[model samples]
Target chain A: MADITKSRTDTPTLWVERVHPAVWALGLVMLFMPAFANGFWLFQVFGWTFILGMIALSLMFLAGYGGMVSLIQMTVAALGGYGVAILGPSGVAQISLGLPWWLYVPLAIAIAALFATLVGALAVRTEGIYTIMITLAMASAFFYFTRQNYGIFNGYSGFNLVVPPQLFGVDWRQPVPFYYLTLGCAALAYAAVVYVARSPFGLALQGTRDNPRRMAALGFNVTAHRIAAYTFAGAIAAVGGILLVWQNAQIAPGTAGLPAVFDILVIAVVGGLRRPSGAFVGAFIYVLLRTFSPDVLTAFGLSNERFKMLIGFGFLAMVVFSPDGVLGLWDRWRARAGRRDPLTGKERG
Target chain B: MDGTNAMTSRLGAVSTGSALELRGVTKMFGALAAISDVTLTVRPGERRAVLGSNGAGKTTLFNCVTGDFLPTSGTIRLFGEDVTTFPAHERIRRGLRRTYQISLLFTGLSVADNVYLACRGVSRGRFSLLRPRRGDPLLTRSAELVEAVRLTAARDRLVSELSYGQQRQLEIALALAGAPRFILFDEPAAGLSPTERAELVAILTGLPSHIGFIIIEHDMDVALRVAESVTMMHNGRVFKEGTPAEIETDPEVQELYLGGGHG
Candidate 1:
């Protein structure tokens, strides 16, 4: 009966099977990572990668599934970071006078969400190149506003925030705690995105992307759906920001600047925009390269600064050869390889 | 096909409660009136064909009904509810669904996903965020409709990759996915081959009685095969209304549309 059920579901359909073996194997690698990796390396590189991956993953949900390419994800993250920093118990003199972390956290998330809503509303009014320009303009405006505002943002210096509240007497700044916290957030964010993508609203959002006119004819307000998608995307991105403040113990205008904004786009595009998992994969690769490239280049008898050139060339090559990004290419290769699972003895990814 | 499905040629289906009504509808693009003072009634289970030539107001009439453009003068009611002031999406929610002359589909998504999306639009409200799409009963219904349209073979293919005919089939599949009481087909057979066209005809003719449709077509034979009543539009107004045989034999229709002499 089980076999019959498996074949019945599998035959003549591309319904995504449960987590691929490759993903499972990767998860197992993560479980065993502490055995060999040093705390410092893991804390700085892997931790940052996962957080950035979460943010990029959120953007991927909007772009791939919702057919909206937003350039303001970094700005949203900055808002979240700023939210926590300014609202938490101790902030750089200008931002947070004194607010408990618990009260500050929710307030910051809400503010970030509201900020995202405004951006989504304005940006969604246009399509294609116009949308890109609008979002870019919004991001640029946010960057400048943060850079120049001394009263609320403390000018270019920004703010040094309190450590996130220690829960159950466990300090989150320690490497293991931070790593676990980041992993937990990433996992939750990933599951949420997948759940939403597979949800009725997600389907409708995609439908709006596919044919706004048809969706409208079917009683869907296309603009409203797009805005709602943006708001959802904002909430996810904002969570990453809260974590960002937790990690850096600070917030600055540079965090929301064009470079950071562009980096988020790079992470999402390089990760493979089609699936949520692509963001993590892309982030892992990006963080590894960005963190270690200087040392790796020096070891190879090159100037450390040359690493940026290499990264640029790599991005160019990836875009030219694989527009769908690495995960998409990997999926294509897997399909071509004709591999079958041992457990099921049927076609599976 | 049955007593319930039998054709009722009443001039106005409003007495039984119209699914849609367009009265004294007039539309102008700048100085040009694409349509003028037109009235149309789409009844429950009514299969209507709006027939016209290249410059005739066929698309214009459609635009007005779907709220793509508000008529200069007219009232559109759905199921006895006044809906002239409603926007396109509100009209859809009110049980009026439609397709386009061009197959407008989410080209990046799987065919199953496209239909599933449409079905969700019909079976649920637009704001349902908590309910997941996979394994949902209504989504299953969408998959069933995909099979009904004979698109099961290409269900997983991205809509962009499908052949033109398959895209049209998918388009109709999307329209039917919502299980709407009323559907508008704008030139459904525009680019289909003979076999595909016949298949479309069969699909349209075989739709369940609870559903209603208004079709716009240039192919007179296909229209004659499916539509219970024909509405001929020329110079914006509905020039004539009758069965297929009556329009084909009308001297005015023959002179203006079928050429100067009888075939």
Candidate 2:
């Protein structure tokens, strides 16, 4: 029994070894839903979840490991969306010559990374509450900049970019194809986040997070590691931005606004900040809530906008009650059930 | 000072020779001289102590050796390599590990986890995401260090839950985790009870001879008990260096510390 427990807990993967088989079955079922669901349901629900998950994964990498709770991940995603809209063949009045897909994608990623690096450069200098405030300030500034910049972003009225390129002559926007595309992007982002989280760089980042002075004494450059993490996270969020634009066939300042930015934080926190798996789980639950909550609220004679009250209250409750978030609660339940290995063991020393 | 002369006189005081050499090391913060032009050598396997009162620049000396602050003027070398300008991490990579005056374990983690973290090769370029940390060679080393410190009983306990002495033991274990060639202990017995202090002394004395140690201690008893040689520090300079008995009998050492003759 001890050997079995050790084998199950000691698996080299992330948190999957600890998950219940029923949860795995549910995930498998969800993955194949696009095959039966219509294009509207698939695109509006599953596609949005994937994009949100990818963005949350980026924030998870920075906040969970790097000790930086950045509020500008959505802002950087918007930069990527605008990068293509303004630089690709989409802007009403193109500022410069539009670039090819290959060039535009890489350029947008780089610009987004640079933008995140600058934000990290400032925010990394502060710790705890100050970091959150600084990043939030940056996010607010980005939101307003896109809102007021009529020449490029078209003010509040954003441009509708052409759909993503047909891969092998198959329209990727179709229900099944687009769902697969979103899944592919999300899985790739998840893999990358997990990979980076376990890498030497990730260990160093966590080490700095654990004890920056100790890490500094150990010869790790704390600030450089933080900036690198921010840049890496930005690149991931930019991928989500590309998917976001692809999903909606549009890029608006509103999508990159405060609500969207706060939504990224909500996804990360709701999922849990401790692991990359938290991103998908959090996004899945949040997307489910977003899609169905309005109807549920209306049935109860509450305004749809007031659904935010529920979300905000739920978020506060999670933080106040379970500081580690939903995954933490799940882990606690599994630990009690003896069906999964608990993350609470020995804590890492 | 006398320690400089004694270092040259004691043949084979260290087998691996000097890992760190300080020459005319001085540090001044604003108007106050925290450390005067004090010179010292830490030969491999040598267990030396710097005995000083408060504000005697013992901690300042450590800061300079660890590269926490660049010396106002002078040179520092590790393994005969100039490291005066090297940063703290660089110094650490070069095999210098130190414990602070205050215990500095990662309080958020378990005691075992804190030790494991310290043992991790932060400066090593090899990092793998696919591999679990269980296979790490350093983890076993950390386990061994934890066992050696008698912390295996509370290995799973959070660092915050440990007793004060246990935390100090963990701090030393953390310093040892990196497998540094030399370790610096700053007032390791500062707040410990008599029994706790004695246990810490035993731990320090039992350390393997391959690792050099420079201990800055306020408690003369603990310092003299574990240290092979004790150097008295007075006003930021080495006042005397001798066996514990010799230093104990020295009039200047007594006057510097207690303002009286040896008891």
Candidate 3:
């Protein structure tokens, strides 16, 4: 006999759904920021935040939804930055290939994504710490390789003059256009992550994350799903990396080193590893501290470099007080307000 | 290796039914033979149970058949196709699905989602993007599985919140979701209250005969009652195979397995 029993779907609270008030509020602030903020603030603060946020969000997609922690995300982004610089005009002499932007941008993204798939193929077989270590090793190796090679990488000086091209009657390198460019890419990355999570493939990846053995038994290819997730994350980071080069007008081995790689991890963890929006929140906090902490320290007669200490303290405080980051704290507040029957807290989207 | 195998499978006198045959199946972890040169066959639409005590290699045999572990040396034919080296997922895609002894599930997900994934397991659009998981086209089919397992009331509840009995029921729903012709259930009635055990036995025996099953249960009373035929294993080998009435009265079966401890 067919199902005579009552059937139902668990509807997540409607307020938290798409077109959320919080998203609207954020969008409104971002839209007005270019008009309100000076050029220094626009390019250094907000544009940088959007770029780093996109890169961090790429890591979040893998770490949060797929249960994988990759330390190679920043390094992967640098690969895109290097591609953009090498394929176009740069401070380095002949290393810049002088190719058209169209020829190089997609090629850069494809290379990063392919590399991510290869890394995922090898790493997905191992769990937790092993995955992290492998990614770290690969990232470290790439950093060293770029530093020593010098021919393409231009040694410690790296590449400079990696400017944004003026296209469609607008100078994109200008503060307003650059801010819009970064904001648009970040929004696309954010929306893509949200949509993919609800897709069947994303669902299957989560299932694999929850229980690999069971997912495999259920006719899902666990390894393939993980690699696919990595590839998608790679594309996202590549976009962010290209944006970073345009914003800085430079790319270097330092951009792909241990410090940069760890910074992205800290950002993703402090925002909320479970939510796509958390990446932006974490990046905003990070960029604000890096930009303003020096002035705050100098006012207290401490050397501005002590700002690193403040950042470290901020990271510790976040980890200890809110293990899942700022978004997690927000989720708890919402749970209490919602008064759901079981307050196990935030089955986040 | 490609077309010939496909053509032979398509045109050959192969039985498209819940049938399985194991020839000299053996599984060794280093030197220990978990399942030692055991051979058995189940006819289509027959009710069967594997009876063995703790450490008797019953689970190992189940693992080998389900492709969780490759047999040391043997041939496994499911529905008349040789699949000795096939992986667990491949075996499942071929209509032989199974449930674990420990009741493995995506505990973080809701009960409805667990059933929904099972529906997707056998579907062609399992990897499709740009489609939401909530309105999965096969939602109607998933609902039926939830209802069949009598989990519709608690469908929206998180799986971690369910009682042990309910988790076992969800396990059955997962196995059934694939629309598998043959299902292997490992220790299905192991951890349940007496009433729950009775209800499970009733559910197991009540399932349609078209879907055959091999249940590995240690409870002799429950296993014998629900199964039409029985295979008793001792020290990793089949000691006896017979009808329930015949096994319940055999002297050797009693001395070796049923009588000595639970026989």
RMSD of each: 5.5, 6.7, 4.9
lDDT of 2 by residue, B72-186 (tens): 9999987677889988877776678899888766665666566655665443452444434464565566678889888888887777789988988888888876556788899
If both were scored by lDDT, which would come out higher, candidate 1 or candidate 3? 3
Query: Between prediction 2 and prediction 3, which has the larger TM-score?
Result: 3
Candidate 3: tens digits of C-alpha lDDT, residues B161-188? 9998899999989998755778898988
- Models ranked on lDDT: 3, 1, 2
Provide the TM-score for each candidate, comma-separated: 0.87, 0.81, 0.91
Question: Model 3 off-target regions past 4 Å?
Answer: A1-18, A336-349, B1-18, B133-136, B260-263
| Alpha carbon deviation, residue B188, candidate 2 (Å) | 3.3
Q: Which residue pairs in candidate 3 collide? A: B258-B263, B259-B263
Q: In candidate 1, which residue ranges exceed 4 Å CA deviation?
A: A1-17, A91-94, A296-306, A332-349, B1-16, B130-135, B152-163, B193-195, B208-210, B260-262
Report the lDDT tens digits of candidate 1 across residue range A213-327. 7778766788888898888888889988888878888888998889888888888888899889889988888888888899989999999988667667767877998888998
TM-score (chain B) for candidate 3 is 0.90
Give the alpha carbon lDDT tens digit for every residue of A232-284 in model 3.
99999999999999988998899999989999999999998988989999999
Index of the highest-TM-score prediction:
3
Q: Rank the candidates by DockQ, best first.
A: 3, 1, 2
